[model samples]
Structures are given as C-alpha cells and as structure tokens.
Target: MTWNSKLRCFFLLWVLNSNIILASLESEVSAQSDVKDHGEHDNEDYSLERAGSFDQIFKIQQTYLTVQVDQLNSTNTPRAKDEKRRLLKELSRAHGKWGDQHPRKKLLDALFSYSRYFERNIPDVNRWRQLYNHVSSKHKRLLDRTVSYTKKFDRAESLLRQNHFLCEDVVNEALSYYEIGREELRKHIADAEKAGIVADKMSVSQSLKHIGRDWTDDGVSERDGAFPCILDSIQSLFPNRQSSRYKVLLPGSGLGRLGYDVAALGGFEVTNNEVSAYMNIMYRFIETQSKKDAFQVYPFVDGWSHHVTQDDMFYQLSFPSMTMNNSNVILVEGDFTTVFKDSKDKFDVVITHFFIDTARNLMSYFETISSLLAPGGYWINFGPLLYGTGPWVQLALDEILTVTEDMGFQFVDGPESCGSLTFPDKKVRNKEAAYGYSPRALTKNAYHAQSWIARR
Candidate 1:
C-alpha cells in the first residue's frame, strides 16, 4: 500500500466513473432528441389547438405523422442519420401539446370499408358512401384518412397485381385495409360478393386499359370555368363573331368539358382535339348520354383540404345535356401537333386549358395555335406550368410571351397574373392535401400562371 499505488488506483477509479457518466448522458440526449424530432416533446402539448379547429388540427397532426414516417422510411443511411439529427435539433427548441390522439386510425377503417365497395358494381359506391357518411361529422378525419389510404392501397395493390416487388410495410397496410372491414363493412361486403361484380374484371376500352380509371371523373372542365376573367374576355371580344362561320379549336381538350363549355355558348363550331382515346371515349359517352339526367362515373377518391366523406368518394358529373346548345360541337381524335396540319379550313379562335406545357417543344405551340386562328382571331390560354419529369424544357412567362409575339401574334392582354383556382367550389380553395406521389418539387405547382389573349 505505497502512496504511488494508491494514486494510480484513484486515477483508474475516476476515469471509469467519468466514462460511464458520459455514456449515460449521451444515451439520454439521444432519447430526448428522438421525441423532440417528432415534435412530440415530453414536456409540451401539441394537441389539436395549433390548427384552430378540431378538423384542421387533425389534418396537421396526421400530415406530420405521415410525413415523419415516410421520411424515416424513405431516407436511410447518411441522409437518414442527418434527418434524425435535424429532428433532434428541432425538438430541442420547443415542447408539443397532445390533443386527444387524432383520429388517424379511423381513416384507415373507413378507407378499408370504401375500398371493399369497389368489389361490387359501380352503384354500390353510393350505397357504401351512404352508410359511411352516417358517421358523425366530427370524425370526418375518417373520410380524409380514407382518401389518403385508398391511394396508398391502390398503388400497393397495383404493384402486387403486376408482380412487382412490394415493400413489407406497404403490403401489410394493403392487407390490413383489405381484410379489416369484413365485419365493419359486412353488409356492403356481402352485397358485393353476392353481386359477383369485380371492378378489375369489368370490360373497359383499350384506351383505358391501365390508367383510365379516373378520367371519367375528370373535373378539370369544372375547374376551368373558374377563369371567368379569361373566358369573359374571350367571349366579349368575339361577340360579333358569326356562330356558324366562326370555328373554335380546343387542343388537348381532356374529355371535352372545357370545349363543351365553349360550344354550349352556341356561337362557334367548337372542335375538341384530344390525343387520348380514353378521353375521346369519355367525351362521346358524356355527350351521347346527355339525354339522361346525370351521368355517374366512379373516380378514385382522394383530397387534402375538404372534409373527407363517402360523398366525396365519387363524382356525379353534371352535363347541361338537355339544355346545352351543342349542335356545333365536334370531336377530333388525334395529336394536336399533326392533327389539323393538312386541313384546308382554318379556325376563328384557338383556346387551351392546361395544355401548353404538355408540348414537347412549347415554342411550337405558338405556330400551331396561330396557324389554327384566323387573322385577328384570339388565342386564349390558362393553366399552370406543372412540369413533372418531361422530355422538353418548360417556358417561363417571358419566354411564352416572346414566342407568341415572334410568331406574328399581337398580345391583346396577359401573360398577366389572374389568381388561379383548381376547383370551382370556393370551400376547397387553398386546402392542403397530399397525394402519395411526389413530383419534382421545383416543377410541381409553380402555378404563377397567366392568361394570354393574343391575336393572330
């Protein structure tokens, strides 16, 4: 027991205790960081209050949950570690309030029920919707959840059916939705099974083979009507234009709704040019069936902003079929770039909605649109530059204006900002919802769009 030995022993003991304390502190810091990263801080309440209303709060909460889970899953390795660190830094700043757990699970339940209805004839959609809507409005989260999950499950199902590799979580979620509602949606399920109607087996046109499921519910025309300033300007300018003599061309007229609107004015021979056979078929079906009161189509359901309900699940598209002045309406099935290139007749006007950006060479649109229009006739356009991955470059506002002017057209008005609306119903405006797919962030919804009325 010399002094040197005692000193060495003391040093060893101190080092051991210090290392243990450091390790424990690091572990505790990591745990706190995880909770904070999720904004589920132990100390703070992130309850539904921050969102103003219960529904709003529920959406915010659900979005956070969905996004957080997605981020964790989608990012692994260095990025994942970085994200975890970012979460920790964010959490260290504040506490969260916990409201009664948002009804995220209820959404899954409702989606399972609604999706089961798809197993039967189309009318069964309304039947299932009626029962599902009977739930209290307070639980609207259920419907919203249904929209979110339906798409996820749809994608999952599509991949599985195609024999594509599926993720474990996606497969589990799909199975849960498929099987969970056997008891809850029992009657609908039974009715579906007895009816022996399968949505997958139903015969559809070749054009609709894989992706036309949602075209019939295409509400773009309804939304296009929201551009009153643009539409009004065109109508006023062309009021004196002869009805029988003046021809209107709508290139990229998806399902012909917007073009129908123009033809229904009864002043122009409107020709709807569409490349997709699915849309052409739908346009004809809507026009031919206009003799009926209303045409119903089953569209895949999803949304972010509106209260989710089974009522929101499908579209009962209304056509002013009985009253519509559609004698001048015609359908031309072909690509716009080459469709009318050889035609001897020219048009009095060419108007487009959401079509310009679809062009492989956007500048070329000016040549086509101008060629279609008569001298001093108008070319009015509306739509966002929603560029998903594409083969061609997108044109900015200046580029669009320059191209039109260079093509020997006089700019009557825009390339001017007229606030855009995607849905005609004001209730749904600016309400945020996320579809499962993520387009390029920079290109998606860069909707600082303008309406241009140029005269050729």
Candidate 2:
C-alpha cells in the first residue's frame, strides 16, 4: 500500500472516532438536564406540609382547649364565674405568648387569606352564619380593624401604582399595628374556649334554622361563612335534580364543607375523600350530626329536604378504586394523580376549591379532571391564584391556563370576587410612604391573584 493512502485512511478513522465521543457526551448532558428538570417539577407538585403550618398551630390550640374542656366536663362541682374568668385570662395569655414567639407575617397572612377564602366559598348559608358567629367577637373586631387598615394600605398601593412616592416608615408602622392586632385576635379564640363558649358541630337542624336569615346581608349571613366563596360557586353549578340520585365526589375534602353541602342539597349523594385522618373523622362527625337532624326534619318537610340515604354517601381514607357507580358519591383517599388511573366512568360535574393551584403538578390535576369529567360535564372551581411558600414554587398563571386548555376544558367564567368582602391589601400590598422611602421607584413585587371558574 502507498504511504499517502495509509495516512489518509488513518486520519479519517481518527475523525470518525472523535465525532462518536462528542455525540456520546452530548447525549449524557441532555439526559442529565432532563432528569434535573423532572426533579424540579416534582418538587413543585404538592405543598401539603407548606400549607399545614397554620393548621398545625390551630390544631395544637384546639388540643389544649379540648383537654381543658374535658377536665371541666368531668368535674362534678360547677366552677364559679370568677374561676371561669381566670381560666379565660390564662388561655388568652398562653395564645398571646405563642403568637409573640412565632411572630410570622406569612402565617398570619395565610390564615387571614384562608379565612377570607372560606368566607367566600362554602355553599350552605346556615353553616356560613354559624361559622361567622362562632368566631370570637375580639377576632371580629381585629378583622374589622385589619380591613380598615387594608383600605388605607390600598390607597398607598394605588399611589405606588401611579408611581408616586410613599413614606416607608408610615407603611411599616401600620403593618406593625396590624400584626399586633392579629395576635390579639388569635388570643380571643383561646379565651372563648376557656370561657366554655365553644363553637360546636353544626347539626343539620341548626344549619337549616340559620338558612334564609338575612340572605341579602353579607354581615354574618347564612350563606357567607368560614368555608369561603369558592365552595358556593361549585355548589351553584350542580343543577338541581328532581330525585335524590345525583352523585358527587370531592377529593382532598378537608373538613368536608363542600361535601356536606352537596349532601344537603337533597337529590345528590355526596362523598368526602380526605387525606388527613383528622379531617376525615371531623367530617364524619359533622355528617353524622347532619344525618340525625336530617332524619328528624325529613318527615315534616318532604321534598324540602332531599333525602340522602346512608348507602349513597361513601368515604375512603385512601385513593379510590377504579369502580364507578351511578348512585355513589365516592370519596377516594390517595394521591390525586395516581387515583382513578383506570377508572372508566366520568362525573357529571367535578367540584374543587383551592385544590388545583395548591398542587405542584398543576397540569396533572387538570389532566386528571379532564379524564374524570364526562363530555359536556362541568368543572367548577374557585380559589386565589397567588405565589406563596409550599406547593406553589412559582406563580405561572399563563402556564396553568395553557395546561387546562390542553386537558380539554374551556375557561367558563370567573376571576370575580366570590363573596362580598374586599381583598385585604394590608397583608399583600406594601405601603412605602408609611415606612419612609427616598424618591426611588417602588417596585411592585406583590403577588398577583384572581379567582377562576372553568368548564369541560
């Protein structure tokens, strides 16, 4: 063989080997990047722990109150009024101490937001009124003050919006006062419990009694209460059925307000599937009370109350099995994405409030809903879409809507305020003027939010 031919052959072989190595390196990098992206997305899917901090605090408070109440319940001797006052004072002091120690603006904001959300959503008017009355007067006063402060803060926000200067010191001072007010208000719940003024379970009879009471008024009315406005919008979408045969399902049904309302609507059989055992037990107790009262009222007001048979209401503390039934309101307890993967039947209407945005897998939730909802069925949901710690790693409203459309649902209506109450700006909007600011542009880094309603 010639020397030139040998050199050319060697160079070509070397070039080919180099290209193969480069391709291999590129593939490895691409795979690693894909894995990293998947991990990041997975981390953002659900924020159960993030959302539960306030719930944990409230639960701890409830535990202490329950223990004290049990002690009081077991006692044969009736305590003097003075002793009651002392107990109340002690409880209030304990709560105040805890609040001072925690001192989390985020926690306070979340609680207030959740309460406001509840006040707008839940369907039952009577239950709403009960919850409003259940809140301590001190809490009410503080909430009122917070609302007023929020309006003032909004003025500053508006000024900022218009690119005007705001005093940062003034804003900070107002926020400080608002925080103090919230702490004081929290103490009121403990104080009330110590005074033996507890808001017990709302029986069906009690709920019915409160119905139609000041329906037009938003001040502690039967329809506007603790659960929120989002829940009510979902309820409104369930067209009235003549027979007590309609079935409803609620996954992640915390405290079961929406589920109970569906059951109360008469013709619908409702199931509340909750992940938390504590929530499940609480819901079951409430449902039992409702059933007992319902049985009592059923005979006299035939057709006034939609008769919900015990068999119609089912609950599972885990994810639902793939079985579908026409008369069943199945509450499946499990990871929402994995549950019903093989389910053959779709719902007439799927209801959710504040559930989708809370999930890191916003797309998965929408896809699951689309799969579960029958053609021409409705998807009724309401909740604030805001950036926060926990499940919501980022605020991507456009991304969310895009995913919803991909899942075959159309945006029906909403982004409207669910209830009569105004958004509290004191929590979200910064008041730079109150806090003392130099003549610099105030960057609007506030969380953007809107309530939505969509249909399939």
Compare the candidates by lDDT and give the number of the best one: 1
**Clash number for model 2?**
41
lDDT of 2 by residue, 80-122 (tens): 2332243234334344446522323222322222222212222
Instruction: Give the count of colliding residue pairs in each prediction.
Output: 11, 41
Q: Residue-wise lDDT of candidate 1 within 135-159, one digit each (tens)?
A: 7775767656765533433432332
**Candidate 2: lDDT of 296?**
12
For model 1, the stretches where C-alpha displacement exceeds 4 angstroms are 1-227, 241-244, 301-307, 314-325, 414-446
- Model 2 score (lDDT): 0.36
lDDT of 1 at 455: 79
Clashes of 1: 11
- Model 1 weakest 10-residue run by lDDT: 1-10
TM-scores for every predicted model: 0.46, 0.36
